[model samples]
Target: MSEPTTGPAGAAFDDFVAARSTALWRSAFLLTGDRHKAEDLLQAALVKTWRRWDRIGHGSSRSHETAEAYVRRALATTYTDWWRRRWRGELPTGELPERAGDVDEAARAEVRHDVLTALAALPRGQRAVLVLRYFDDLTEQQTADALGVSVGTVKSQASRAMTALRSSPALTDRFGDAA
Candidate 1:
């Protein structure tokens, strides 16, 4: 990983990342549904935010909040752009990987797999809205802002995404009526 930038802007940026990286990583993971992709997404977003740290008013009381919003926006836009230009050369196989020894871990992995499968089926916009509004716990307006969409668009996308997920075979098979 690259070293943190020096001086005031660097200090602020470093502090923001240190304090919020875990939560940000969760958002990224939910958005990408893959650990390596999530790490790349978060790193890309953080780099974008770092480039504008001074302009984002690093010394202000609300600097961290501003930086958070900027980073989230970056994450959403970058993911969408990547989706648009995605290379589909790689294909998934039907074979399942070996299970973990721990029963609890295996159950958690199953749930995660089901959820990721369901999420992967969503349209890019709907997936982004769902991740931002639900997983990241952002309000509809905040999600809209992050996505550069209107609040109504966020609401509709979220609703449609939820409806699709509720009907998804991956989730339905796992959770039955609850899904």
Candidate 2:
């Protein structure tokens, strides 16, 4: 397929967006589990990226990997920020409370719902750390850089999250099967 050409800045930006937009939006949606929120998060990240496009391009990396790193980090932090606003109550949900639990693939869907709920219930820092460490496969230092926190913070967050997840019956049931 022929590529769309605009200008140096516009074309470069457009190409970057076109190539990465779908994956980034999907990642955002998976992280947030809300379509509207995902759209807002991705848009915000892209806008910030566009503002820094010139400076970012001036860096040494030709692959735009640094830009991708920035976008992922921004989106992750934004999701965590939005999640905190929704955590006003102190109630605990052991099983899945999701309304979208109905699925033709009942067994797996049940496990997935529980996992999502568990992830959502985790403290913002812990959840972000877990997702960065396990889901995104980023190292502690990378996760710390992404969240603008220290590596020690990442380690502590992961330690706490792992402890809680291990104590969680839902996760034990789900993950035990994997092991």
Candidate 3:
């Protein structure tokens, strides 16, 4: 699709992306647990949001807020859609392809991997809830709005996700005595 690059709509869209893409990318990475998948997810959500930009941009004085919410909601729904379709084009292996050069970096990478592995084990709804509520620092109401779920669902999912994370072997194996 052709994007508007010269008009007010184009400027606003570009500005929004520039301002928020990094934060949005972090949310996407937390959601997907993989860098490439997160990039794909963010791109797809942005494209979807861009398609509706005219309507989103023209209707309100709070157009920026509206556009942000729309983009966030799009990201959440698109992720859910992709999960439901079960698109598993890549498989996890038992070993890292390359070792970290430094011991400190290796330790950090291991911790990050374990955390990601634990997060990846969660059901999509719970994972999404945790990512939105904790990782993205969104409120329960905001998370619910983004996920198209009720506030209660968000709370319950967050509770369950935390419980699951606490018990996940990927985490407990590394930090068993600390908890």
CA RMSD, predictions in order: 3.0, 5.8, 2.8
Between prediction 1 and prediction 3, which has the larger TM-score? 1
Writing each residue's lDDT as its tens digit, candidate 3 over 26-123 gives 98898888789899999999999888787787434588778778878888889989888985678776653446477777788888889989999999
User: Evaluated with TM-score, which candidate comes out highest?
Assistant: 1
Candidate 3 local lDDT, residue 31: 88
Report RMSD for candidate 2. Answer: 5.8
lDDT of 1 by residue, 4-36 (tens): 479877887878889999999999999998878
lDDT of 1: 0.87
The estimated TM-scores of all candidates read 0.91, 0.74, 0.88
lDDT of 2 by residue, 72-115 (tens): 88888777776667756685445534446556566666877777
Off by over 4 Å in 2: 1-6, 58-63, 83-104, 173-179
Cα lDDT, all candidates: 0.87, 0.75, 0.86
Residue 141 alpha-carbon offset, candidate 3, angstroms: 0.3
Residue pairs with backbone overlap in model 2: none
Query: What residue pairs clash in candidate 3, if any at all?
Result: none
- The C-alpha stretches of model 3 lying farther than 4 A from their native spots are 1-5, 58-61, 87-90, 94-101, 177-179
Clashing residue pairs in candidate 1 (N, C-alpha, C atoms within 3 angstroms): none
